[model samples]
Target: MPRFTDAFRVAEESGQTMAEYGVVLALVTLAVLAALTMLGANVSSALTGVANLLP
Candidate 1:
């Protein structure tokens, strides 16, 4: 009984940790996407400017 309880606790902890990691990964991905979105227009303009400067 004690061994079973320990196993269950370990499984629960592992699941919780996995969930936390997933959330963090999702948040980081969203932040990166947001940063790219905000900078997209500026990046486009910079590229256009560079292209214009080329012969």
Candidate 2:
């Protein structure tokens, strides 16, 4: 029926949107982790430097 078809279309669109959001979230998470990994060494050095500066 027409109602059933409309429901199916809506569901399909929602599923696509969900998939897109999931991909974006995964990419963002990966980017954040990569940034942290890259920055961790610098951060550790900075902390060490700060500690050395202390008494």
Put down candidate 2 lDDT per residue, 2-35, tens digits, no spaces.
6766665553577788999999999999999999
Clash pairs, candidate 2, are: none
TM-scores, in order shown? 0.60, 0.59
Clashes of each: 0, 0
Candidate 2 total steric clashes: 0
- Give the lDDT of residue 36 in candidate 1: 96
lDDT of the candidates, in the order given: 0.90, 0.90
Runs with alpha carbons beyond 4 Å of true place in candidate 1:
1-12
